[model samples]
Target: TTCWFAPGSGSSRGQGPPQQFNQVQTTYFTSIEILSDLYKKKVLIDDYLVDAYIDTGSKVNIISYEAAQNVTSSMEPSNVIMRGFGGLHAQSLGKVAFKLFIDDLHINSCAEITTKSNLGSIDLIIGQPTINHPDISLVTTSKSVTLLKNNISDNFLTEMQLSSTDFISKVTLFLSDDVELSPGAQCEVDVYTDHELDTSHVIVTQPKIFSLGNVSYFIPQAVLTKTPYRLQVVNLGVHSINWSANKLIIRAEVFACRYVLSVNI
Candidate 1:
């Protein structure tokens, strides 16, 4: 809320006054309906509508410490740390199982609990973990977004040629059932690409460790071109999984799913 530029702290030094820059702290939020996912049925979380902030820059989903307390489950002790853009880690109350409906969709996962009052009036902060929904689209020009299922023919299409930076393929892993991440627990995998898509050289990303829930999807995001593209996901987890169908399907913070990468043909 403060907008004034101060000269470099020590102009006396030869560094001279650094370029003046405006520092602005802003927040983006959206309205959403909240519900609890349960056995064969769903219930509203607070018997009221909830407004959630859509933050594309965040890696993990966050629920205010106070909000998490309102849920029916008990908070499990977790060592997961929340880190901001500057790498400053924030303290958390702990992690809790959260099942809720937002934007007319269902979300069942464990959300880290934060008691910080800085989230403004919103109880939930939708982060990147959910924002990558395959069907979601954000139009800043109109301040609007699109989500969920839609026909590719329903919209304009642009064929994408192979590019070094374009991810031709994607990979994911899922626990058979809801499993909690243990302290110091992590997963990793190596990604490989082939010529089935017709690229001369194989583009392989380094072994990436998984860190989706907290400060970590440490998994290496392998890049690639084809449907169910020819690739291999070497499972590194003895007890966990390694490869999954990589699609643009992600949960959105439009108030977000999985890591979704799309190629237009």
Candidate 2:
């Protein structure tokens, strides 16, 4: 997702374009489950089990006040600032470290975050640091996710072996010599792979293009609303190849359309 935030009043605003400001982009992972083993007891919370959003944008895993209290009874009262669609809000804080399990992969000593009930039914927001494992791929779709782990690595080769099932899809990788774009606009490059697959494991090496014919793709929105930008496609599956250049911008506009119509009505 790409987000455009208006610049605050400052001399820094003069450093860039006048109308647009900074652009924040994040690769979102969702429909994930986090299982915890407190002592000898196991606790499983699926994305459906407890409201959760896998946010690469967040740096730490945040658990709701009610959920945090339920998990750890020794939470202390503290103040923290939480940012969201409605802007910044003050939230109470606490800490806890629990074993986290995403899909079949498990990690111990994961960071725990605490927040107020204002985050709604979400039990927690899983951040990047906890889920940024090297062996696994976090595929984000319009509604779901598929976690793919490469068992051929030295760490997992002993525990498991690579199989045909690991090839979830035949992805065609592409690299642009120089990515061109309009100022304050974003673009999306679509590459058609060999088969329709569910996992997001398209790896790009140096000179990342399979074939040059009709391989160069473009979309018409500025990803960062600024002149210079870098694009990295991670954890992409074949079925979800049609990447959006300004997903956040589109989402925001769509969300506000109803409100604008209501006001006009």
lDDT per residue (tens digit) for residues 4-39 in model 2: 223222222111112222243221222222232210
Q: Per-residue CA lDDT of candidate 1, range 91-150, in tens?
A: 445566766665455556556666545444566766555656555443232334433333
Clashes of each: 23, 6
Error of 1 at 15 (Å): 43
**Per-residue error (Å), model 1, residue 98:** 2.1
* lDDT per model vs. reference: 0.41, 0.38
Candidate 2 — which residues are off by over 4 angstroms?
Answer: 1-49, 72-80, 109-116, 141-144, 148-265
Model 2 weakest 10-residue run by lDDT: 248-257
Estimated TM-score for each candidate:
0.36, 0.36
